[model samples]
Target: MADVATKHPMEDEVKKTEASSLVGKLETDVEIKASADKFHHMFAGKPHHVSKASPGNIQGCDLHEGDWGTVGSIVFWNYVHDGEAKVAKERIEAVEPDKNLITFRVIEGDLMKEYKSFLLTIQVTPKPGGPGSIVHWHLEYEKISEEVAHPETLLQFCVEVSKEIDEHLLAEEEEVKTPETPSLVGKLETDVEIKASAEKFHHMFAGKPHHVSKASPGNIQGCDLHEGDWGQVGSIVFWNYVHDGEAKVAKERIEAVEPDKNLITFRVIDGDLMKEYKSFLLTIQVTPKLGGPGSIVHWHLEYEKISEEVAHPETLLQFCVEVSKEIDEHLLAEE
Candidate 1:
């Protein structure tokens, strides 16, 4: 006969005591004189670059498996903690670009000797009405026994490295600043294949943008002539559209019209987009597919962000793609 197990009377109480004593969490925030996006990007996408920024604390970092900025990637880090050289092997648990957060779980390291598990998270947020950011660090750990010390020294090391990185970034920004150039600028480009003639696609954007809303009713609510005449340089148009589930508007001045090349350029002069960008420029070029019955549409975006808190205009580019696809389908149906 199998023996029946019986629970001890003090088992529940002992379990509670062990849980409360072994598991702990630590958190701290440090003010930084650097852009939050840049800082977050470095850790999330380019951790190897961090060694140059804080050589004293972070000697080096290398990818052991998978690609950078991806979950389940293993990374090895060499560093100094509490005046002693140390190393850590970590796996990326999560990467949230929109939230500017990255989480690393220590899988094998010196800490594992004393702790059963350890997790580190870093999040950066832009300072309110200012030119800096705040870095928040959080640590969750479960010690093997209550006799082990809390990881306060490791948290302090993180704070010191953060300050060092901020100084390095500030220096780099100052070196690139100038009287005529914006401090931070970015560009994005994408191409789409459409079953529509290049001439019709070009004419739709350059000559008859006012009719675009009808072709892409869901993406574009409406468009109206704001200034000048259509199909001419210096003409202005206003666009109302939905982006990332929010309604937005843009007032663009026709900067260039190249009929021979089937290209058109629009520069945003005012609207909700300007609130986040110092200047935003968009260009569209369409060409007949060499070996097909349709056309190829090239979309480009160039912009300078007002601050690091503002994310790149990826959703705007996606909006352009959706509008192009819808217009292509509409044109094909008409044909």
Candidate 2:
């Protein structure tokens, strides 16, 4: 070459820093007068509904990979970013309902073009002895190059969206609360794809209760037939499960069974869960995936907590997800 290129010292240092695995982080916190559980649920389970609450900032959120409320789901967002229409594709990386924390990783879109990686985590915690909650937003990113600008505008946009969502939730709370109606019940739904036959999965939980421990022994310590034949309505089933690092037992009665629909419902009548919940019902529905050989297991929980002070059933739902995966893996191995 006729001419040799020269790099400045500062530019070389910046390149060195960018080459290393160092990530820049920013955090923002705000306090709002909305129910902490409601706020957490909106972000954790129903983010698609956020467009209705913050239409000015978020146009819509569409699920691309998995079902809502399930980890590993990919969501595409049509949003306004710095006075321009933009899209961001993110994956649900981690969800800790017990702590009201949800983390999302940006895998594509405008942010990815400027950064090597981007992660956004939102957490809500009840204020001590107060009527509101504290929401924390944290952003972790690695720039593709030193020339990329800091994400100050992105942080401001998040703050504005949070404020809008808080106001929207408060308005809904006022409209729903009345003398005739009191807040009492809460429900959670989760879906997992299993590469197994739908009929086999349904029969395992329905007619063959004793085989659960064999399939997922770590999660389900054991199961015993307490009363009528296995999988029949009015029959009783007792389960020993490891939940929240504790070994506990639960007594439930078979409420309904539909072979045509591949569904089974169990109503908790006694044991550890009853201590905190007035009633707990679990429904498992397996449906054959359209144009596929596998199945989708839909797990639904309807429960009434003893009081509003108690936490939502996030841990319980997580437990369900673990068990579902364990069973799914066991089935796949058999094939």
Candidate 3:
């Protein structure tokens, strides 16, 4: 395996220079000290139990450069075993031992055509305190065109692989969605206590945004909520509002619900919210990551759209974004 790139080496010629402005970057680092052992065990070798035989395996993702564990080796898969899928080949460019960093380049594959090239660096960097570690990822890419899919496809793969790894690590144990008992919500803010317990507060926070009464163009302005079984799955809800001063509305139907897990989802039924939008789904879930207190709230969303105008999910996504923060503040104030 090659050594990790410590310094950003300067290139003399502009042979491979980029002109496009940096679009955006998303980073999700987690300090999972308790999971260190599990990680080491699962990654000790080719995870046969995890099985790399499936299609879309991207060949050699398990191998790295220089012929070490997942290094210096290339592997391939048929994606869904549809029997007709493209092959991908990548080479491990650099590997750091102490830092647990591995960098690779997809030198051969269909992806290279549209992506030109991409640098995927994964490192398990140590956190400031104790034995904790951060799964650090750095992705630098040269887009092939304005129509190229930038981060969506890559992000989805990262998330899925993360989940799979987590699943493998916690194989023997099951996640207690809703414990037999409600975990003690340690040191909650007083306001959060009063508000969360208040009928109006729960009513406001439980469903869609009650604050926005209209959907103004380019904005999540006016909107209202309508739903059956407000917090359960199979529950249907509708939002009518104005964006940028224009009246609009989208009907939503609940597709899934895991109450014990405090998760409920809704599919957008109708709306001109985005020209590229054909459908949207929202998931509201509350997880007590800190057990008694200090819970990290994660509001997960999934969308599949067709229109270019409505493809930008930022505006519509803002509602969930704000709610997560609001919930955190409300909890802290009461703590």
The best candidate in terms of TM-score: 2
Which residue ranges in model 3 land beyond 4 Å of their true spot?
1-18, 22-26, 30-66, 70-72, 77-87, 126-132, 172-335
TM-score of each: 0.49, 0.51, 0.37
lDDT of 3 by residue, 1-335 (tens): 12222322223111233556333333344444435444433333333223432224322232212233356644222232223455455665665555565666677766677777776666665555576455545666777776865554564454455455655455434433545422221111101112232222232335534443321222344344455565445555566554444667776776876655555566777666434454456655443321123232334455545532333455545554554445445544544
- Candidate 2: C-alpha RMSD to true structure equals 12.5
Which candidate model has the greater TM-score, 1 or 2? 2
- Compose the digit string of candidate 2's lDDT tens values, residues 266-331: 999999999888989999988775444777777889988888777778898999888888888877
Candidate 1 residue 154 Cα shift, in angstroms, is 0.6
| Residue pairs in clash, model 1 | none
How many clashes in each candidate?
Answer: 0, 0, 48
Candidate 3 Cα lDDT to native: 0.46
For each candidate, what is the lDDT? 0.83, 0.81, 0.46
Best by lDDT: 1
Q: Which scores better on lDDT, 1 or 3?
A: 1
TM-score for candidate 3, please give it: 0.37
